[model samples]
Target: MESARIPFTERYHATQHGGIARAANSSVTCKTAAGRTATPCAAVQQGGAGANGHYRMAYIDVDSDARTANSSSATLRIPAGSRVSYARLYWGGSLRGSGQKAAKDNGRVLLAEPGGRYRQVRADTMTGHRPHSATEGFQASAEVTELVRNSGGGAYTVAQINMATGHSTAGVWGGWTLVAAYENKKQPLRRIALWDGFQSLGADRRELSVRLPGLRIPANSHGLAGVVAYDGDRGHGNDTLTVRAGQHRAHTVRDTANPANDVMNSTVTDLGRPTMRWPAYRNTLGFDSDVFDITPALRSGGDRLTFRFTTTRNPGYLLGALFVQTDTRR
Candidate 1:
């Protein structure tokens, strides 16, 4: 398939506007836990989607430890019948935060087959590609290194999957960052139906009953509680980001920074553990006037919460965030 010649601005707008449709269609074959060739129940999109199909940026927490904390690879699902003709993975290692700008790199895409696992498709490839900027969107016209270097952190990779054909594929390609191409047609704002949807958690042998108050904001609101999980790399302290809501004080929390567990009491040195649970219960919940006017408040949707994590650390640390929305419609 010919490369999609999308304008840099157009791609940027599309990526931020359209969130991911579906990462992988169900027809793709994958090795199940039992070691049988099986189809994934659903196409898993690690990071949250942006406005359109564009995905929210994820990171690789290379904070203190560099060896074990560094990420190796990530996975992207493809439908059973859809043919993945072309694929690419974008990465950047720049510094641009508070007022910092690091260097950039030109990353490459490596192919992986079923049963083979996500081994490096190539070893001689150079790591100096500019990741597609929020403006560049899905097309590989941008470099991957800039995204990371610009973020004021270590190196980072942005994954994208190219699906010109919407059909399912045989075996899903691993390490392909499937980014949002473009809509078959322009979607109007009025056509947007902001409603609560159901997310099925089929794994872990557990079920959660989610509650959505509504889409409207209530006059008087109380405390808030949410869940934060990590992917990619080693150690628990990797997941760290600053969260701000209008005049409310911005707070920074690491995946292992939960007050529930006493750091002094725990003997485990590593913070980011699979079974590490953060105590997440609040007493009284109230929403101040400043809370209603912040970016977090405006973007308050039932299933939409800003989650920042490293995809480079473990290649799977696609952070997940869920916020409760109370509709004032009643």
Candidate 2:
């Protein structure tokens, strides 16, 4: 089955609430190497190695609980019946130094799970600072599907750059933006129905039609089935429902005036009045369970299915809902 992707952005700020990294020498005073006065610095200095090294990088620590206080961490919930099959994380920002080492120092964006486990989502090796220029930084992304799937379909969480490791590098100083992609699990048997709240058919309107597109049938699938529910003005009249592919008739269900006459083939009931009255009919046509099949009616290269209704009396028939089902193939 084909999958669907849902994209969501993190709901937190990267720098607020003590999320940035600052080195011990981040505020060090710079003195002229030979014979000049020390200069006051505004940004962390680049180059040099040691405890008081000048290179320092800031990072956002994305914590699951930080969503309320910091906003850098986020939790995405999967719907109750659906499972997550795949996921990915995207993040990007700027680096402030040059050369391979500075680029390597860019660190990585980490994805954190609920139980203190973490995985590297993407590397932030984009380096070089272009001050006051249109082009300024590098952007990167990473796939976190395994971690997301392991989280078991609910509350998948993520952390900002270097937060999971608690180690900060120099020459990396920009806020990061993040978004996640997820694929929903596929169902073995799928049902597509037509029951939009505000639509129906009647005497004023004699026919109702619906077009369903993009339905996929796996190579190992068995077949398809369909059912429809309908009613008339006084629970009287003969009507027919048809399923088609372009001009090809796939299946049809016909209603009779006498409920008892079609009792074995349909369900006849009185379901209220005005809003819903009696003489409602529900039936499934084309093949019984032993040999149920409708694949031959479906066009091989196309995925368009159409449903139609016709009536023969005044205050004709109002269609309720039409449902089509297909076997699930692993």
Best by the TM-score measure: 2
Kindly report which residue pairs in candidate 2 clash with one another: 12-71, 56-170, 188-328, 270-278, 272-276
**lDDT values for all models:** 0.21, 0.30
What lDDT tens digits, residue by residue, belong to model 2 across residues 1-330? 101111112211111111111000010112212112211122112211111112232232334454321113333435444443334343323333232222342335555554545555554222222233211223334445466556643233344432111112221222222222223344344423222111223435566666665455443333343222222222233555556654455555332321321211222211111101111112101000001134555534234566665665543322322334443222
Candidate 1 segments exceeding 4 Å error: 1-11, 14-18, 21-176, 181-232, 236-238, 245-330
Candidate 1 — worst ten consecutive residues by lDDT sum? 282-291
Error of 1 at 151 (Å): 32
Candidate 1 per-residue lDDT over residues 215-236, each given as its tens digit: 3333232222223121111122
TM-scores of the models, in the order given: 0.24, 0.29
Which candidate's lDDT is highest?
A: 2
